[model samples]
Target: MSVPENQQEAKNKKKRKFEMPDTYVILFIVLLIAVAATYIVPAGTFERELVDEVERVVPNTYAQTDSNPTGFMDIFLALQEGMVQSGGLIFLVLFAGGAFEVVERSGAIKGGILRAVNKTKGKEFLLIALVSILFALGGAVGAVANSIIPFVAIGVIIARALKLDAIVAVAITFGATFAGFNVGFLNPYTVGIAQSIADVPLFSGMGLRVIAFVVIVGVTILYTWSYAKKVLADPSRSLIGVLDEGKEGESPLDAPFTGRHKLILSFVGLCLAFFVYATIEFQWTIDHMAAFFIIIGIGAGIIAGMDYNKLTLTFLEGCKNLVYGALIIGVARAILIVMENALILDTFVQALSVPLEGLTPVFAALGMFVANGALNFLVPSGSGQAMIVMPILTPLSDMIGVTRQVAVQAYQFGDGFTNSIFPTSGPLMASLAVAGVPWIKWAKWMLPLLLMWTVIAVIMLTIGVLINWGPI
Candidate 1:
């Protein structure tokens, strides 16, 4: 009854189609469910735990909130009220960063950064470390994401063309910058705000922050290199896309090096040296970070031979990209309206903050991760998130016999990791959208890298807590 081997038959072969991860679909569903549940649960508004902090912040800015009944409509309602103003932050940072992107694309800054990343002058690893330190210094002085994000994209593009993984760009920019952001040594935003709330000296934790920066930079390089290898092997596995960076009708390496590039680099170097010396020595604050980048744009624009009018126009164009992300985050902020209505955020915290009555160092770190992730939704702003969570968390850690520094480390991991992938959070989503990558697509690449980081963070957390890294 069987057909002879060669003569009998040919069958159609089936091929597997590419599928988006189930997790991607789940993110949207979760958003919808959160929206619907907020409506079904009748409620009151969330109390501003950081209200005192906010009062001192913008000094009676109209952005203050009050509790209210919740509904599915509340998410949109929050956006309608303009409750999320991060769009402005995004706009500013991205504009400056974007301008740098175009400038680099024009071949003015790319060579300088590459020169920074890989140099014939010193050890290669040390040069990579130096690139990270400079970026972190940018953050320490209060350069926000608007600037950081575009810098990230431009750096990614350059890295890809240079055969380095874009993950290195991401890890260095986000991790080093956030680590510096957390340090608040002279950080324009959170460090000052947090110090005031903690009633600690403005630079009380300065040394620790510097250490954190080094630690995180090391982690970033380690993770980035590891992740980049897999992608280099099989491009599909990369979270950061390899872009066709050769802009339309333009050559990729048209004058990759020019005197204009060196001049801009010299101007930037002079300005950075002046800024850093002033910050550490004279303790100056002319909003120097923003001012510095602005100067870089003007100087780079000129070096690239862009006219003043074209420079100004391109600057504005770059800023436009950030608004998209800011608006998306504004949309995500609707959850706060829901949580406030449900009276759930505090309840959630109550369960978490209590009965840890006694936890070992490792368990305490684990608890911090869980609590930080959940609490992040309610107080999503990192500055605000830390103010609300850290105070309670720091005290709770004492009860568990863990150091506040360990508490801080735990907070960092929680704050830093999820932003890269969470759709409920806007900046990451917006960044992905701008790059023409979707959340689902990003998650595929990030999943493996995130797991690596998670394992590393846990290990680091134990080291912090067990070694008792902080003062008693």
Candidate 2:
């Protein structure tokens, strides 16, 4: 081969070697690894105590029990159980999909978004920053992540209309929410549940969390806006490629915005406001949110002047579009199920904590951050992870002279930020599917931002430890 040809061949070989496996395949491999660990790592359990009507771990109560390595049949059964367990989340995705579809078909969503885009014509950066912060605030309040799923498709459409890529859409929607969630400014899922388990007053360390929230969100806006400018400058630079396929073809704004579109969009805005309010006041679950979306869809269809029959069909079509993304939730849940059934969840936590035994308080807090990130891959649910991990960590933090608040901070940071990159995360996968972007592309795009978030996390954690962030 000629020298240049040899170099080209070598590049192709390297690319092939680093290629990402299919998401399903990667998940299955992870399940197998979890199964193997069950046999290698000793099975264990932590005694539980009822704190504030919730089950929490009794610190230092971990005791090894008999090994329960899952057999092939057991793995299959676990997968089945996982799907059943994830029924609420799966249904939420479907309902939200159907609901958003109804709105889309009615043309209200696209029209309003396009009108807004046109209004911001010369200041697209302002649009990205404002929308991201709005989503981030919603996430900061909690129960907004699942609610935001229906809006994922809407976000992608808007990004394309604004001359950006699929990555920007996911970043502004899921990524922004996650950053707010990770910083944990009043996020009930992570901070509430975690602090409850740790026996700290609920939201006791709000001052620190507020500072962290601003820093994280500001960095994220700059990161996403910078990438968006690159893609706009050279359309070929877009990771999603030309997004013309499978869309409504002509610009949605080509049709003039009408009074009907205004009313419909206003109704949706009111529904979203209620969603946030009721979620905080009533502590609404996924099922409640799902039902709310269904109601919104029906109302939107009626207001947009769709006949009953047409509305029904459009709603069904929306659900059909989301089937792939919904199934990703069920399949991902199986990873947790297999680990839970094999009784390795607690064992892994115990093993990961062993190294922190002799470390200084500052290092121990940092170690907790690292361990929580590792644990996040196997257990991605924020509240679920908090319930399982916090009890053990609270006591560990005390022994190392790290405040319980810092431990909760570490836990939230670990559980929140990694979701954006982990294949096991249902929301991340679903959002990517909605945008037609591959996990590998999203992960590669997210690496720098993730590293920056980690640095922010470590720095905040260190400061918390030094300040003796305590409300114990």
Candidate 3:
């Protein structure tokens, strides 16, 4: 090991080819790390008490128990639980993707989008505003988690057509949804669930949340439009610029809009409207939404003049295309299952609250924001995290003299914003995959915007506490 030889070896290492790992590989590593954590991290539990017929963790009931290490076999058991737990979400992704494929194949979406793009040619910000508002409202009221999955591909294509980058497309679509969900004025999954746990009136404390939503949505629009203008000015500067084919120069519509296209587009719009209405008003589960999509696909196929054979095959093709995204959702769930089987999920939640107990009211509220943000990695589901953390968080907020509404709002803010950035988030991953953007590239591009959102979130949380945001 001469010094010259060591230097030569280092040079050789530097020349080694850098290959970005597959998304599945990264998730698999996370699964193994979680399994390792089960052994390394102490086992603990919290007493479960039923409140309002829903099981919840009793605050201050945490206790370290004898280690019941998750064996290798337990990993298999965890996988099974993950599949069972994520079965509904996985199914929704596949089915909805298939339905959207049918709609896309009909050419209605293309025609309508092309016409819309033509109208907004010079004023691209108007297009961004319109789309952002729609998606944000979708996130705010519809709890549209998997609902956005099917549209990511179309959004990317539209972004390209509009001379924008993949990041702008994501911001306009998922990013807007993330903003609305982050504010969560009427989001049933995060806000509704947390409010229920806190014993606050459902959808109460809307006054401040509405303001937060508008501010966030406005910022999202400005940020996205600014990026869009940059990319439009120089296509090579786009985050996905290397992958961009300069599709902006291509005509979005291969042909003119027809009567059939108009009818099909109208049908698709009505279906979307029904989806939002059904979700907000009737509390439609993912399964119900999937069924609705299935019906839409079949009906649209018929309207578009596709024969029975072609329709079935198109639907199947759509499902096949999304198989990777759907499986990732289930695989991501495996990480949570391992934690659950090892009984470390509660330990993770309980341990976070230790420091918050000592902080002042405002800082404690802020601490809650940080805690929920960190926990979002472990449990990405809004409703699931609300169920897991809110029970304990609600009582802790009360103990520290922070309003329960503030606690719920913190949870909402924490859970929603990270979805667009976290790799472990299935929907985020699925959307990236659908848009053909690499995780590393997307994360790098989104980091600055995420930091901006973080600052805004802090201000929003402080305002909530200062104003005593509540229906307590």
List runs of model 3 lying over 4 Å from the truth: 1-14, 17-20, 121-214, 223-255, 259-262, 272-283, 360-452, 459-472
The 0-to-1 C-alpha lDDT of every candidate, in the order given, reads 0.53, 0.76, 0.74
Q: Is candidate 1 or 3 superior in lDDT?
A: 3
Arranged by lDDT, best first: 2, 3, 1
lDDT of 2 at 184: 67
Q: Is candidate 1 or candidate 3 better by TM-score?
A: 3
lDDT, candidate 2, 1-472, per-residue tens: 4579889999888888554455457567777887788778888887876756545556577898887788989888877886797676667667777877786677665465556666766788988887787678767755356556766776776677776778898888888888888876655546765775577765567778989999999999999988898888998988777455336565544545789888887887788667656755676655676788799889999998999899999888877876765665556667667767777777766665567766888899988888899977876767656655675687566546788899999999998888889988888889899888899999999999999999999899999988898753
Poorly placed runs, candidate 1 (over 4 Å): 1-68, 82-88, 102-106, 116-206, 219-305, 341-344, 355-366, 370-411, 415-472
Give the TM-score ranking, best first: 3, 2, 1
Instruction: Assess the local accuracy of residue 120 in candidate 1 as a C-alpha lDDT between 0 and 100.
Output: 25
TM match of model 1 to true structure? 0.53
What tens-digit string does per-residue lDDT give for candidate 1 at 1-472? 8766554434312244554333224333444565565445443222333432331111112222333445556555655543343333334345455555546555554465556654522343454466666666666655444356555665555444545555555555554555454343454334443333333333344565566556655666665556656665677776655554455564332235667777776765576557656655665443445555677677768777888788887766755754443343334433444454555443333445456645666897778876776655443455545544554564455446676666665765676566555655555554554445656756776677666567766776777776775521
User: Model 1: which ten-residue window has the lowest total lDDT?
Assistant: 55-64
Error (Å) of candidate 2 at residue 65 is 2.2
lDDT of 3 by residue, 1-472 (tens): 4579889999999999985466567667778998999999988887877756545567678898876677888787777777787676566656766777887788775566556656675677898787778678768864345557666765776676676777777777787888888887755446765776576766667778888889888988888888788887888788777235554457543556789988987787788667656655675655676677789889889999999999999999988976875676566677777877787876776676677777777899888888888878866767656655675677577556678889998888788888879887888888887777789998887787788888888898788788777663
- On TM-score, the candidate that comes out on top is 3
- Cα displacement (Å) at residue 349, model 3: 2.3
Worst 10 residues of 3 by lDDT: 242-251
